[model samples]
Target: MTLDPSVVTAFTPTGKLRASINLGNPVLAKRDPVSGEPCGVSVDLARAFAERLSVDLELVAFDTAGKSVEAVSDERADIGFFAVDPLRAQAISFTAPYVLIEGFYLVRDDSPITRNQDVDQPHNRVAVGKGSAYDLFLTREIKTAQIVRAPTSPAVVQTFIEQNLEVAAGVKQQLESDASRFSGLRLLDERFMVIQQAMGTPKSRGLAAATALQRFVEAMKTSGFVSAALERHGIAGASVAPAA
Candidate 1:
């Protein structure tokens, strides 16, 4: 497939494709324990996009999704991987999602919050990763529960424990992992929301960049590249999103 030079330039203004890698979102990206290098479906997708553009790939690592979004909004990153969120759309032009993951509530095993629907209560204090899709969604959806923001997604569980929060909201996989690591924690069976993981470019990059990104994502999905990437990375709890 021939890429338009203008689109390529817009995605790589500095002549290298700088992708903001958010390690906090385990479904998208993770740190390799042995090498400390970033890996996972998002990393694979970024590498594929850089290869398609025939540009050198530069991974701008950020520990949190909020920082990753800021990096792209500030134009420090040519492109970024993020959960498609309306609140973040003000600064980013997100393509159709390439992967879909679930959001859930984590609570103490003996806590009264027995279901996802029970999370929003008058006295409930919900802990969430600052600026994440969960935080943004819950901010708009929860009318009663007070939200306490943690510094990052991976820190949400610990923050909940440390603060004695009634409920913790985050990626389902991360919460599940936390449940296994920490005793007395359990994830609600029902999902609170579905996270649409997508690639984003700065809004200032214009329509061409957005169109190119959307096409790239759809092609990756239809061509089985996304499925292959997930399999290759051994990532679970996420599926290739339907073509948009």
Candidate 2:
């Protein structure tokens, strides 16, 4: 793919393409248990983008999506992987989502809320990661239940357990992993939301860069690169998003 020179400049101002890797979204990026390096579908995508640009790949790691968004907004990173959230769109321009991950609620096995619909009630506190897609979504959609913000997505499970929250909202895979690690935690079978994971560049990067990224992402999805990366990384519970 021949990229416009300006697009390259917009995405690699420091001569290296710094991609923000948010470990908070475990489905997208995670720490390799053996190597302690960032690894996952998002990491693979970032590496692929860098190679396509013929630039060095720099992983700018963060613990939360908000921080990753902030990095791109601040021009500290060239691109970031994010769940398409309207609140975040002001600072960054996003490609159509390349992956879809479900968002679910985790509640105690013995809790009264057995169904997803039971989560919303007066006095029911839902623990969520502050500035997360779910947090932003729930902040708007949830009319009755109160939301308690955790420091990060990975921290939500612990916050739920420690604080005895009525519901814990996060990525389904994450809640499943947490349920296995912590007994008595059960995820609602029904999902409340689908997270649209996409790549983003600072809006200030200009239209050329944005268009280039969108094309790159769609091509990656259409050609099966994103699916291959997910399988290679053993990622579960996420599907390749259809073309925009």
**Model 2 error, position 228 (Å):** 0.7
TM-score of each: 0.97, 0.97
Q: Report the lDDT of model 2 for residue 157.
A: 92
Model 1: number of clashes? 0
TM-score of 1: 0.97
Instruction: Report residue 22 deviation for candidate 1 (angstroms).
Output: 0.6
In each prediction, how many residue pairs overlap at the backbone (N, C-alpha, C within less than 3 A)? 0, 0
- For residue 123, give model 2's deviation from the true position in Å: 1.4
Local distance difference test scores for all models: 0.90, 0.92
Per-residue lDDT of model 1, residues 1-244, tens digit only: 6788988998888999999999889877888899988998888889999999999999999989999999999999989999988889999999999999999898898998898778788899999999898898999999988999999999898999999999989988888887787898888889989999999999999998898889999999999999998888777878888988
lDDT of 2 by residue, 47-154 (tens): 999999999999999999888889998999999999998888998999999999999999888888888788889979999998889999999999998999999999
| Model 2 segments more than 4 A misplaced | none
